[model samples]
Target: MRYADRLAELDSCMLSDALDNLGLPGAVAGITPIWQGARMAGRAVTMRTVPFDGRRSTRHLGAAALERAVDGEIIVVEQVRPEGAPPAAATWGGLLARAAVHRGVGGVVVDGACRDVDEIRELRLPLSARAVVPFTARGRFVEAAVGEPVTIGGVTVEEGDFVLADGSGVVFIPAERVDEVLAVADRLAAKEAVMAVALEEGAQPSEVLGRTYEEMLHDR
Candidate 1:
């Protein structure tokens, strides 16, 4: 199966453990779905929005990324700020959600903040953002680059990287490491399933989650 197809079957926590087992750094920190039950997995199309430099342009924030990305891909927005500046402006909003929906993109992942939560929720476009605010990016931030490596949620996510974002959190997988990561995650998931079945059979909780569970990562 394709990477995106395979990743869609797994959640962030499983992918996190897989990364840990492989000594990789892809567990995104402080990023979660803005709405409950929202999940997305696809290749990453990265973009960066930095604090404005006292100038303005006709281009809209995140527009370039939307145009550059193909269907079923995720646009990752990395919000950069001036030194000692606060993350106040919103890089994503309702209009973008509507566009994403029409474009058939997987969803959006924002390293900073997003606005228009109500509209986005109504639109039902899955979005994962670090924060939410009413402030607009106008005159505060500008699109700096598209299709580049970006540091999002403290993780260095590159273009074309596999991304899985769900309730637990967002986890990015390097394009080169997807096979190994998927193999490890699949094993861990299988074991966890057995443990769940044992629990349902009235097995002792502690016994089901004992040293064996603790050392499952290194067992491979």
Candidate 2:
């Protein structure tokens, strides 16, 4: 099955555990879905932007990314800022959300702030971001590059990598490791299924789930 299809069947926490079992690092931290029950999986189209220089243009920060994205692709934006400083402005908003919806794009993942939360929610476009603010990017940031690797929440996401986001969090699966990761996740899901049934029968989670963590990692 296609990784995208398989990914749609799993959640972020399941994928995270699979990555951990395989010794891979792709769990993005401090980023949460903008709406409850929002979930998305797609190939990534990366964009890296920097705090706007006094004289540089800030036109079309997200427009370029939308144009470059194909159907079912996610735009991953990484805002460049000074160390230990907050983002100067929101890099995403309702306009971009509408464009993405029109283009059939899966969703957007922003490493910085995003505005127009109400509009984005109404549009029903899945969004995951670190923060939300009303500041505009017009004079605060500029697109530095597109189709380049970006670090979101300490996870390096490259163009074409598989991005899966849900209520738990967001995770990036390396393009080359998708098959292996999915295979492991499938097995883990099976084991967890057994535990789930046991739990419904009044079994203790600590005894059934916790005790099998390491055993399942090494099983099969």
Question: Which candidate ranks first by TM-score, i.e. highest?
Answer: 1
How close is every model to the real structure, measured as TM-score? 0.96, 0.94
Which residue pairs clash in candidate 1?
none
lDDT, candidates in the order shown: 0.91, 0.89
Where model 2 places Cα greater than 4 Å from the true spot, the runs are none
- Which window of 10 residues has the lowest lDDT sum in candidate 2? 211-220
lDDT of 1 at 150: 97
TM-score, structure 1 vs. true: 0.96
Candidate that scores best on lDDT? 1
Tens digit of per-residue lDDT, candidate 2, span 93-169 = 98889999999999999989999999999999999988899998887888999999998877889999999999878
| Model 1 residue 133 CA deviation in Å | 0.6
